[model samples]
Target: MSDDSNAAGAVEHREVVVIGGGQAGLSMSWHLTARGIDHVVLERDTLAHEWRDSRWDNFTLVTPNWQCVLPGYPYSGTDPDGFMSRAEVYDWVRAYADMFGPPVREHVEVVSVTQSHGGGFDLETTAGPLRADQVVVAVGGYHVPTIPRFAEKLPHGIEQLHSAEYRNADALPDGGVLVVGTGQSGAQIAEDLHLEGRAVHLATGDAPRVARFYRGRDCVAWLQDMGHYDIPIQQQPGGLGKRENTNHYVTGRGGGRDIDLRRFATEGMSLYGRMVDIVDGTAVFEPTLTRSLDAADAVAESIKDSIDVHIARLGIDAPVEARYRPVWRPEREITELDLRAADIATVIWSVGFRTDYRWLRVGVFDGAGHPCHHRGVTDIAGLYFLGLPWLHTWGSGRFAAIARDAEHLGERIAAGAREKAAA
Candidate 1:
């Protein structure tokens, strides 16, 4: 509520400070504004930068458009079941911000956040120093791209890049491309390359795959009806550990379809087990290709089985569909791959990203550096986290459920403010 000058520079203060400007931060801003909380959203880059820059050019949201809902702004497009492309997603987020006009300061990065001696939070930002009574770290967990240390051992001639840096098949060099990882990004990028007639050598992992459509509707629709998305992380099979689980690999491209690695193998895309190391210009892999593939298929079928049960229990007149059978399997254990012999000109590491929170000089985090919170509220009275996967429910980190999480945090923040005023 005040901008004052200090020895270092000018200090702008507010009742609440929301870090990050993505859907999560914006949603939080919406709720805070609704509750008459004075706050500023600090973003390191432009609004919705991830959708505009980090995602691949051909990337489409894995979830349908209907799930892209903010606090007050819902997907108003005609095709609710269709997926939004990278550009469309960026535009939609921008539109949401424009609609609400949240007090978002774009291009302002927070360098550090710590407790101020005066019973509040102090923030050191790129623009200037700021202080707030409460802070909401809406930044999602994924920050730094994770690549194995063995990458340096690979030949310098081979072009190496993380999945985030990948744009398209044409952007890569001539000859084959080795994609290491079978997560959602890896699978989709592999399919993109394969569609472009690029020879792809995929290093598979244990990431599961789900059918895009089952029975008479999209699998997402069926899951939504079964209240799968409403399940809280605490009630999940693996409990909070489910947050580390790799997302089921499926594509919304070309109007959504199942991504069967076995089908890809049958189409001459070489698939191998997890890449262990790169030694002497050769990539070593585990001999568990069959096991990895089978595991993925098993997960896909398990999801289908759940859907069947849900249908039968509801007595819904859904059309019966045949179960999935393996169309192809690896003939032998191909454990080693010579980069030179395979003519792999590029190596795309689609492994995943790690959360970076070194700047947050707070004691609220666990030994693993993960923030300890009940929902978004931390043990520290005014410190909080938002937009993290499985923070409360399966949809906590996603657009489908961020509004609810933000609303909850907003109420908590408002209550805290009222209590302070009373005291």
Candidate 2:
């Protein structure tokens, strides 16, 4: 890479530029380097910063360690089925970068990416300007944490934060904790607090749940054997709509297990339906607590049913397992919750995140602001996206399948560079 001073500012030039230095970016870099492509990776923060900082103290990968496959560096840990903790995850990614040195610029933020009139792309960054013949946006969606608008009306004395900001039960103010949303993060975090003996009130959403283990192996192992993870997004049951589906809540903490909100309810963790609004200093919820719980349980059983079919079809010798049954049910609809009366001092919003592509001034986005791409290859020449959920397959956004996606993108990028050179 080289830099030249122009009228606007110092302009660094590269054949290809990659944004974000997480696993996605690093994986892309790995492929690019192997193909002898010259590129620079610009990271807004330190490499693997998300794993190091965003997760809670007790967080672990829902998927087993064996799934962590970068471009070339696969997980070599002894226990393939065991999950890696937050610190271990960070170290793993960092070790990948160290093993194969990528031309990564840490703390250099790419403020904007736009098409250049002279061909290629122009990027405005904290360091200055950059020109690239091709660009790979390795940043996965979920740029901004989403909280309900009515959260502002909550009592000021009650501390509020996004699940991303939550570390542990001790970090929160003493009193009952209200956890909103039942996605993987919310469910696990709620379990984290409940195990710590903190007063926990969980507000559930429409997210599904899955059993951690079934028969004699992890559910994930069964799914993998059944070729569930290998299905392309286009061939998925819901097709592209599957991308919007919330992940089933499960946990890898303490040797991996299922997250049963119903069990939590029986154990004194208050369960309510989705929080709709805060009115008159009171929290209003839909009378869908029972519905949500049933839906989650139903999904979990559906997974087990699929497993049973797979086992029977192959005539495998897996041990027979009993289907899950709801252990507890709501006696009555509890639609209103008074924060003060319930002694709920902390509200953690685990409602998920929103995509922020405001910095991208390209016309490759659709009406929904999602990038218009076919397996990460956008319509616009030399522009691409990587590491999006279901971008090509169920594993597209995850560690298990990123290597394949990155390898494909690397081939596309290299071919594009060759075409440009031939021209």
lDDT score for candidate 2 against the true structure: 0.92
Task: Enumerate residue pairs that collide in model 2.
Answer: none
What's the residue-level lDDT of 206 in candidate 1?
89
lDDT per residue (tens digit) for residues 1-423 in model 2: 654533445677898999999999999999999989889999999998999889999999999998888887989989899999999999999999999899999999999999999899999999888899999999898889999999999987999999999998988889999999999999999999999999999889999999999999999898888888879888988888888899999999999999999899889999998899998779999999999999999999999999999989989998887878889999997999999999989999999998999999999887878898888999889998999998898888789899999999999999998999899
Worst 10 residues of 2 by lDDT: 1-10
- Per-candidate TM-scores read 0.98, 0.98
Per-residue C-alpha lDDT of model 1 across residues 79-180, encoded as one tens digit per residue:
999999999999999999999899999999999999999877999999888889999998898999999999999987999999999999888999999999
lDDT of candidates 1 onward, in order = 0.91, 0.92
Candidate 2: lDDT of 81?
A: 93
Per model, how many backbone clashes are there? 0, 0
